[model samples]
Target: MRNILTFLQESNDTAGAAHLLKTSAAPVTGSSGLSGKEIFAQTCVACHSADGKGAFPGVPDFTDKNGRLSKPDSELFKHVMGGFQSPGSPMAMPPKGGNTSLTDTDIQNVIKYLHEEFGS
Candidate 1:
C-alpha cells in the first residue's frame, strides 16, 4: 500500500523506523507495555528483521531451534542489555541495538516475542 511505502521512505531518515512503529497500534506483550514486535520495530529491526534472521553475517537466525533460540532467556536478556559480539561476526550488536531509550521491560518483551514468533 502507499502507506507502507511512505513509512519506508520516511523511515530512511535519521528517525529510522522508530517513528513509524511508535505511531502504530500494536498489541502489548507480557508485562512490558510494548510488544516484542513493537520493540523490535523500534530497535532491533535495523539488524534483525521480522523473521528473526539478522542482516549481517554471524547474526543468528531466531527461527533455527538449534541456534540462538536454544540459549536460556537469562543469557539472551543479558546479551540484549549489554550487547553481544559473536565469533566471526564483522561487528557487534550494540547495547539495546544502539537504542538507549529501550527499558528493561522492553527488552524482555522483545525476547518473549522472539520466542513466541520464532521459537519452536
Candidate 2:
C-alpha cells in the first residue's frame, strides 16, 4: 500500500485524489490470507471488474490513468474503509465490501494488487 502511495505521488502529483476517495467493495470475506488478486476477484470484480474497466456506469475505471488509481493510498483506504456514495448513483459500496471479516491488511494487499495490475 505504501508503494501505491509513492507511485501516486511520483506519477502525477495526485491531482484529483479527492475525487478518487469520493469514488471508491464485498462480503466474500477473503479473510484466509487471500492474495490481492483473489480478494479482488472474490469481491471487487462485481463492480471494478477483472480488466480494470468498470462493470457499470458511474464506477471509475482503474485503466484510466487520470481516474481512481491516481489517488493516494491513504485516500483510497479511507474511501474503501468508509464506503462511498457516488453522487446520484442508486447503489453505494458497502464498507469492507460487506465482508466484515477482512482485516486492514487484506485491503492493503488488494490495493497493491490493484495498482500493479492497473496502474500502468
Candidate 3:
C-alpha cells in the first residue's frame, strides 16, 4: 500500500490512491486536522474541479445558483453519504464521493465549505 501511495504521489494522481487508502475500514490517524478546503482539494477536486464546476457533463455545477447547492444541508448530507442520482441527469454521485474513510464530520465540513465557497 505504501509503495502504491508513493507511486501515485509521484505520478500526480494522489487522489486515486488516497481514496483507496481512505476508504479502508482501518482507522485513519495523523490527518493534521485538515480543513474542509484541503479535504476537498485532496478528495474531490479531481472530478468536481477546483472551481466547483464539475469536470464532466452530468456532474453538477456547484457554482450555479440553481444547482445542487440550493438543497438543504440534510438533503445534501444524505446524498454525500449515501450517493444520489440526479433527476434527468445521467450522473450518479457515489457514496462518500467514493471515499468511505471520511467521517460524518468530514462530510459536514465539506458541506460547510460548499455553502461558504459556492452557495449563491
Candidate 4:
C-alpha cells in the first residue's frame, strides 16, 4: 500500500498538491506518467477519503452507485475541471479538486479510478 505520509509530505494543500503532482516521479502515462490511482491517491484522498466515501457530510460519496458516478463521464469531467455545487449539498467541489496542475488526462484518469474502484 502507498504511504499516506508521503502524499502528505509532498502536498499539504491544493496548490501544493498541484505542484507536487506535476513534479512527482513518473508512474504511468498521459498524466506525467502517473496512473489514475496514483493521481487520486496523491491529489484526491484528502477530501474524498481513502475509500472514496467522502470525509465531510456534503462531500459526495463516490462509492454510491446513484451518486456522482451516475452522471456521465463528461459531466463528471466538467465538474472536476470546473468545479460544482450540488443543489442541496453544503460543500462544493473545488475545480480540479483544488489541484490546478491536473491535466485533462489526469482528471480523466482519476475519474476512471473512481468508477472502477468505488462505483457500484
* Pairwise lDDT winner, candidates 2 and 4: 4
Q: Give lDDT tens digits, candidate 3, residues 5-110.
A: 4544664655554654654332334324667787777666655777999754566899999888998899999998888777765445667765656788888898
Can you write out model 1's per-residue Cα lDDT over 10-89, one digit (the tens) per residue? 53532333444455433323324767787787666556666788744567788887988799989999998888888886
Full-model lDDT, candidate 3? 0.70
Q: lDDT of all the models against the reference?
A: 0.67, 0.67, 0.70, 0.69
TM for every model, in the order presented, reads 0.71, 0.72, 0.70, 0.71
TM-score quality measure for candidate 2: 0.72
Instruction: Identify the leading candidate in terms of lDDT.
Output: 3
Model 2 pairs whose backbones collide: 25-97, 26-97, 27-99
TM-score of 3: 0.70
Model 2 per-residue lDDT tens digits across residues 30-118: 37699989888766775676798976566678999988789999888887877875686445566766456668898998899999999
Q: Pick the candidate with the highest TM-score.
A: 2
Worst 10 residues of 4 by lDDT: 1-10
Where is the poorest 10-residue window by lDDT in model 1? 23-32
Collision pairs in model 3 = none
Where model 3 places Cα greater than 4 Å from the true spot, the runs are 1-32
